[model samples]
Target: MVLNVAVVGAGVVGLSTAVALQQRVKNVKVTLIADRFDEGTTSWGAGGLFRPDLDSYPAEHQSSFRQWISDSWKFYNALASSEHSQDCGLTFVAGTLLQNSPKDLGYSCISELTHDFQKLDEAQIKKMNLPSTFKYAYSCTTVITHVPTYLRWLMQKFRGNGGKVECRKVSRLSQLSDDFDLVINCCGLSAVELCQDKSMYPVMGHLVRVKAPWFKKFVFSDDLYIIPHNDYVLLGGIKDAGNWSRAPDPAKRNIILSRAYAMFPALKHAPILDEWVGLRPGREKVRLEVELIKGGNKKTIPVIHNYGHGGHGISLSWGCALHATRLVQELTSGLQARL
Candidate 1:
């Protein structure tokens, strides 16, 4: 018999889970439900670079860092090579990580695969037009994705394969009946209230998108980054932990723009297209687990939790999706049969 799966959340993580589940099995019905979709999601504002700082991952999780990163890179890199690359906002970019502090960014292992992994010299530093003094830097050929484009592309791919999307809010897990074999929660920030997960909180952030076609490289300094995509450059941002305000602060907007223009003087000539504010679904570590939600009449529904990607939603979307899909398969197939 075919399985019915409901994936809650239309963000990158949820959409990726829906696509992966459908791809993993045949004749399965996948319904993706979320209150917000496409351009409204926090994923839409992400520069979508593939760097995962060691601090981003939880220390206690059983997931292998190498496996997740390798799998995600393979998936996006394949798309980057295909003709649909641009349509999906997957492309190769030369990135520079300007070190402003003593943070241990874990890109060393993958440096060889990057565009260029070299310490900056005095001459290169002078030409970079950056204000922060750095002792070391890593320049790499990395991947950046435009989340809005990618989300639309993924939805089309899922629908083309018989999946469905509903623009509705899921206030409770029980709202989805037992008709579905499993319900995967990819609701990001909403997961905190839906699941009563007090551990989950929001990391407030903001960004400015401007016309900077002349810029082609991605720059990173601490949590702040200025990445250039096809037609626009993304200037970001602050990461305020446990903050939930969705409104952009005027002071932050000015600070971000000033810093970005300082690094790339040409941006001063470009006009700002838009400013956006979002809450990165943050937790001590990303939450990806399985639970049995007991409803009225002692009915138990299987729920696979896959939220809390923090600021790295796009960077880790595919990896977590693959992991969640595996868990769903286990719950539906073998010893873990019904909740």
Candidate 2:
């Protein structure tokens, strides 16, 4: 018998999981359901940089978090090197990360996995046009994804592989249990309501995309960053936890532009292409475990949660999707054995 799987959420995590599922599982039908897609999702507005915070997860899961970062890096690196890099919106860019102190400079988790990770000297910083206030900095090669374009590419790839997408909101998990053999929840912040998870909240982020093709590399300091894509550059942002509003605040946009312009004087007069506000699903820890949902009439469905990735959704997507795929395989195998 063919297994039918329902993946909730069409964002990066959900779509990635669906793609991975179809690629790895045999004789399976996968459907992606979400209320929004492409530009309507938070992933669309992301800078799409591949920098994972080493401290994002708890101490016990640190090893696994590092593995995810490594896997994600490798995945994006391979994509960047492929002939379809431009079409897939993947590009390798070198950048400098500045900090007030050297103690806070390095990401120890996957530092070894990054390309050309090195501390920068004062001379190097001056040459890079960084402010003199920056006492320590590091340079590394990282991948950046043009999110809007990339999401479209992912959707096309998924559809081409026989996966289906449904544009609808899921009010409850029980509603899907009757039809699907398994349900994968990658609903991001919506998991708070869908799973009734109090641990999940929103982290409001604001970014401005401007026409600045000359800005060749990424520059990050504190919570602010300047990420350059093919046609435009992304200037961001603030991380206001517990803020759920998606409305773009004009004052906040001005502040971001002001700070970014201070760092790179050339951005002072760059034409603004678009402004965006997104709510990143923040949690104490990302939930990526399996649960069994028992329904009426002696029926049950396996749910593998893959949400609460917060700002690192794009960074950790493929890695977490691969992990989710493994969980699906194990759950299916166990079910088959029981039958």
Candidate 3:
């Protein structure tokens, strides 16, 4: 018997979950449904850096959060080493993360997961000539995904595996019960309304793409960052919690460009390619669990929530997808045993 699975949302997280379910679960039909795709989604505007802050997760789940981070690093690291790396928009890049004080550099979690993690010495700091306010610096090699390119690649891969795509908006969980045996909610920020999750909000981000091929490394200090993608460089941004405006603010754009240019003088002359704004699905803790919802006539529909990733959606995509897939398998097997 074929299990009809509906994975909502077409962003990186949703696509990743859909692909994983199709590959791991036998005799299952996976269909990806979303109201937005590609550039319309927030995942497309991200710098796609594989850096996760331990503080993002709740204190109770620190160990599980660490596992997620490590699993994500290993998954992307292996992908970057594979022959399909370029096609999948995966690449290894060396970058520096700076802070005003040594105590503020709470990246020990990331350091443990990545390679060549080291504290920057005075010589290295002086060579970079960062502003006087930045005293602490660390360098590490990390993976980055070119969002647009990577999303396109995922769409192709998912379709190639006989996954179906449907363009539709889901307002409630019960709406899917009649057609699908199970539903995976990866609606991201829209989960606020769909799931009636009061804890969920938007963390607005703005970024500017510039034609700066000569810039080869990533530089990040606080909210300001310069990431060199395969084709262009991405400079960003602001993290205004509870802000839902998708329009690019002129004031914020100026601040981003000014800060980035101050850090790297060459960007001052680089031609601006495009500007974008996205709303990250922010919550106190990422929701990745199973819920059995009863529809009309007491029909039980198993739903797996895999959203609330916020800005780390790309970084945590694979790990979260793997976990969600496992939950799905467990749910299916339990039902099979009952039969």
Candidate 3 C-alpha lDDT tens digits along 42-159: 8988999887877667779777677777878888889899998999999999998887767322587788878798898788889987654587888999888998888998899899
TM-score of each: 0.92, 0.96, 0.96
Candidate models: Cα lDDT each: 0.80, 0.86, 0.87
The alpha-carbon lDDT assigned to residue 92 of candidate 2 equals 91
Give stretches of model 3 more than 4 Å off: 103-105, 337-339
TM-score of candidate 3 against the unseen true structure: 0.96
Tens digit of lDDT per residue, candidate 1, span 151-240? 999999899989988898887898686456669999998877898999888888888988878888888887568888888888996888
Ranking by lDDT: 3, 2, 1
Residue pairs with clashing backbones, model 1: 115-141
Q: What's model 2's overall lDDT? A: 0.86
Instruction: Name the TM-score of candidate 2.
Output: 0.96
Off by over 4 Å in 1: 102-105, 109-115, 121-129, 335-339
Error of 2 at 7 (Å): 0.6
The alpha-carbon deviation from the true structure for residue 191 of candidate 1, after best TM-score superposition, in angstroms, is: 1.1
**Candidate 2 or 1, higher lDDT:** 2
lDDT of 2 by residue, 1-339 (tens): 688999999899988899989999887899999999988889988989887776556777777777777888888889899999999899999987778866332376446777688887888877876554888888889899998888888899899999988989899887797788889999999888999999999999999999997889898877689899988899996999998899999989999998897787878778999899999999877799999888664578889999999888998899899999999888888766554
